[model samples]
Target: MNETPQKSQELKKVAECLYRNGNKVYFALVKVRGKQIKRSLKTDDMAIAKRRLAELREKAERLHGKENKNIRFEELAENWMESIKASLKPKSHDRRRVAIVGLTPFFKGMPVKAVGFAEIDEWRRKRGASISARSHNIELETLKNLLRYACDRGILMDNRAEDFKRRKQPKAVVDVLTRPQFQVLVKALYASPIAVASGAAAMVEFLAYSGMRVGEAREVRFCDVNFETNTILITSGESGTKNHEERTIPLFPNLRNLIQRIKAARPTADANDRIFQIDSPRGALPAACKRAGLPHFSVHSLRHFFASNAIENDVNFKVVAGWLGHSDGGMLVAKTYGHLRQEFSATMAQKMTFEGLSDTPPTFAVVRDAAA
Candidate 1:
């Protein structure tokens, strides 16, 4: 016989603890006072049951620390994740959630205070074998932040995850498409009926011309582009810009034409409509590469292509940096694109000459003083 959840005695709703009791009511099966208890929500309405579930879970979590000071790592991680999930971007929140999921298998029942550098080091060494240093570092950082949060709340005396060493990663080489290769890609895009109709060619040219990331490009709306000024506003999206700052890039002639073509095709599109309806630009790029018979390049390569061309053309580094939405003015641009500038310098180097220096000594070098 299922009894209704009492409205009195502070018996409240919560998460992770409810079930349907046949067709009559929802049952709350939760741990209270270290013992599992089953109570009826007495409502078949899912919304009411869910509201009660959240309340129950929150109440239980609040009492967990007071009931037992030595909480398991998994339990503490769940509590910590809930506390900070709202503050993180969706992608970032998903990453941290995954890190927590990966963590529980190793530290599931370990007491928070018992976890230390040795355990973290072992996890790092084991995890590093399967993933890149960057990913490994992120996992370790996630664990470190969780433990740091626990420390701040007085749940633990120290943050042992902090002592785990991060792997040093080398800077990756920026792969860019040469002018001839880019031209080949464009030709291939136009040649293929499917590619041309899909608008992949226009996207490639847009990225190459504007230096915007594929994500940023995809987020751009019709209203974001200003034909009169020849500029496009890059705004934050679901994951936000890399640095979380919006910027505008000048609409170079090629890019401007591409946008114009798109607008002409969709004259009825509202200003709020996304310029490109394609879901993933990179997924569509490989076909063009296969047809072009050139090495497959990611969409990001087009950004590098833009930067390389800008540097080769002697565009001011700061201007290029701003166009690329980099906050460091041109420092990172100089480091990454400086070699192209050097290539230009090398060409100029060949043209240099000391006008006064010659194999033959100056005509009057042997100053025969007639007076002497």
Candidate 2:
């Protein structure tokens, strides 16, 4: 009789029960109606676990009920985020996680079925007012992906977020540093006593010449360099690449010289060790720009400078695209750098010359005599 009473008391306080499984703690023994329920609260904090217990119980009540009115946008998003985290790189995972933060304030506790196209459109309109169209599109895309995941998992009848229109993004103007500006920036990097002596100038020059993204530059290893071929092998490192492809780029003279000096500084450095292990020269770069009185540009602008310069130098479009690791076979290069190509072509036209051409075409009489 006493044992039966104890069992009844335990069941009555189901939400307070907890258990540990391996290193992870879970809220266990939750019962709703005739069913038992357990869930991973995903944390060990007692306060957090208590809070989550209430939410879980509410979730169970709705899931078990005939009305099924408690399924929430936050719940679906949490499930979706967990499913995709393993497949994404750390940086990408963080980006998706950040997108959800903005979404949660408005939609977190709302039912999935309750959210409609108009609500999403209104959110897009309001979000676009403060952020760039590209940034707004990313947030919108994240919301759509979450809803689609819910539909795929049978949590929603359909994904209404998919019907929402994406904000139209304007064509971005590509800004590049001219040679004089690049020289000034380089001078600034080295002029600072704080700048690392291990090829800071070379690093800047390499990006300007090689068209390598900053991340790609940081991942470069000494073994990737081929002194004989005058080329550096570009590979998708552990983080993967922007397009998940690999290609080669010419190791320009200044970059090669700087790399040699860096290698000499670390004579025992392993071939697998990164050639230049530096973070974005954000501090040094911007400070240098300020001192030089040049307009601010990002590290990526160096790559644009390389591409623009290559186009102006009449490098074949296909060749330039390949060197830049673009898989589109130069279509994107043509779109972004076509105007530079036109400028170069016009400049070339002014100097056009023929080695073997008469000052004037043969007269019609001379042509008739030859025919006769």
Candidate 3:
């Protein structure tokens, strides 16, 4: 028979004693907000049951900050994700999905507040030995973000990822081309007989010259080109937008002249047509490398090459960072390109004429005795 829960009726504790397992299980039938609630205390002793009773009393006392009864972390995660997904971009939404991919299994059915350092450490342990530090570090950052989301929505009391003790990995350094190398690459780009049509030559040259991203170059339109002001308008779209922030970059006279030459050849490109359609900006350089017989170059490396050249030539780091569309102030410039300055300084040290240093003739001019 079903019985209604009441605060006045006085709840009863039921104990089930098992002889085979030598375990004693205990539960209480009580009323909370006029509904009957049965909570089981899984233990094998009276002392444990008594301790659990004290814990239940303490939990009941702290109603404001405790995790909700029977609510799972996965359920909370689902609710939290729905609120943020509507505000993020498709790419950003996809990235968030990636952050949570390898994390779902461990914390799925657990309570929102149950995730702690120990549980996280166990999840990481299951990943086994082959995991790289870089990827694991990214996972840690992602886990922190999820906990931060939980705390923001009153699902968790605190962000515990801050307390985690993991070793920080040094960032990977990307190589940039020196001035002679960049010049060689540019010359190699324009070497082909049909280079004008390939436009790979023009595209890479513009990237090297202007420091524009490859996608930005591809999505650039005719109307965005301001010959009078010598500027290129980087409009926002799915094809090429830097985190959806639109900004204009000024063009140099040399770049403008190259644009005119390209325009003279094409002559019929509409104001909004795609600029580089012959090949992907990424693939162009590899093909160019095969032809030029030079070391392979990545599209991103061209931008790095430009930035390093600017810094080596005594251009301000802030100016270089802005020209490269880096949003993280000039930290990228400071961290990566600072090493190139040493090589540049070394070049300066070796720049002297032989006019005054050695007017004396070589000792070979004075024939020595063969017996000596």
Question: Whole-model Cα lDDT per candidate?
Answer: 0.80, 0.77, 0.69
RMSD of candidate 1 to true structure, Å: 17.6
Instruction: Give the candidate number with the greatest TM-score.
Output: 1
- For model 3, residues 148-229, the per-residue Cα lDDT tens digits are 8766655554577877655566777777776787777778767765664568878887777777777677777778888888
Which has the greatest lDDT? 1
Residue clash pairs of candidate 3: none
Residue 40, candidate 1: alpha-carbon lDDT: 68
Better of 2 and 3 by lDDT: 2
Query: C-alpha displacement of 314 in model 1, angstroms?
Result: 2.4
Q: Which stretches of candidate 2 lie over 4 Å from their true place?
A: 1-70, 353-372
What is the Cα root-mean-square deviation between model 3 and the actual structure? 13.3
Lowest summed-lDDT stretch of 10 residues in model 3?
15-24
lDDT by residue (1-372, candidate 1, tens digit) is 234443333333334676764354677777755857565666878799888767665544544356446888888898988898777767788899988887777788898867888887788777779988888888888898988877666565457777667889877787779999999998988787776677777788888888998878888999999989888899956667877888888889988888889899999999999988775467668988987799989988998999999988889899999999899989999988787898889998998988867778656568788999
TM-score of each: 0.73, 0.72, 0.68
Expressed as tens digits, the lDDT of each residue in 1-372 for candidate 2 is: 587655433422323566544444555557777767666677767678788777776655544343444678888788788999878877788889888987787786788777887777677777668888887888988998987776555445446787877878898788779889998898888787667665555677777867888788888899999999998988857776677777788888766887888888889999999877675565567777899999997788888899888888778889888888888899999988888888888988989988789888886743456556
Selected candidate, larger TM-score, 1 vs 2: 1
